[model samples]
Target: MDVIERFCNIYIDICQISPDDLESIYAKDVVFVDPITTHRGIDAVKHYFSNLLTQAESCKFDIADVFHCDGNNTARTQVTHIVNWTMHLTLKGNNKHITLDGTTQLNVVDDRVAYHKDYYDLGEMVYEHVPILGFVIKKIKGKLAS
Candidate 1:
């Protein structure tokens, strides 16, 4: 399979992220960004994933869709891939599951991801999981929406 397919297939296994695993999927100077963190380089990416793996009992991603440019379908191309996903995680030392729905934009270079950005609501992913902050944030949102 091509790098893009392999990337989509394996990148979701957050529990087993390693440099070796990402070697083919991410460039050496890859840039990864999400709502909470911005990091550069593959090691930084690995560190970020390690932190994520440690926080949750188990984490998994369910991809809803992936859209990429149509071309020669080389290992990497001037393409923007949009992936919709739902991540399931066990947080706070509890067995409860917190699922976050998110979308990621991936830019590939030379068969590896050079730039990756994820879009999701901080409230849905984190703030709502906190106690007092959740309540306050929800109240503020309700007031603003109404």
Candidate 2:
């Protein structure tokens, strides 16, 4: 199969597995970096995912788009994912279904993912869930970034 197909299947597999099943898809030498933390190898990746899933339930990913670039024995994919579900970063409070947009960049080597980078605004996820902090955070962030 082609690299893109392989990568898509990997993502589908991730969706199917429980968060505990991270080791299955991640290579032993995999490098996964995201906005908050950087992980090297499958073990660290597994640990990172463990912390993530602890706060969420019925987690689902909607793949909005996938951009593919192929080279000699290598492929990169830029993926847009829409996440909707419930999460508890603290206090285990109830939250409505939220839609979050994020991107993942994958480096494919020999049909396996060798390196992956995920990009997203964490404040959009965290502060937006609060009542008044949501608006204040957005405004402050906008003003600062500008």
TM-score for each of the candidates: 0.83, 0.67
| lDDT score of residue 25 within candidate 2 | 47
What would the per-residue lDDT of candidate 2 be over residues 1-146, giving only the tens digit for each residue?
Answer: 66555445545424345554554445578788878778898878877766655654434555656776545552333332222222222222464556556777776555556678877778776677689999899889799999
Q: Relative to the unseen true structure, what is the C-alpha lDDT of residue 102 in candidate 2, on a scale of 0 to 100?
A: 76
Poorest 10 consecutive residues of model 1 by lDDT?
A: 70-79
Model 2, stretches more than 4 Å misplaced?
1-16, 72-93, 141-146
Give the per-residue lDDT digits (tens) of candidate 1, residues 1-146. Answer: 77678777775766656546877788898888888888899999878777776776777788889998565645422347888899887764777688989998888776778888899998877788689998999899999999
Return the top candidate by TM-score.
Answer: 1
- What is candidate 2's local distance difference test score? 0.60
Clashing pairs in 2: none
lDDT of 1 at 22: 74
Poorly placed runs, candidate 1 (over 4 Å)? 16-19, 70-79
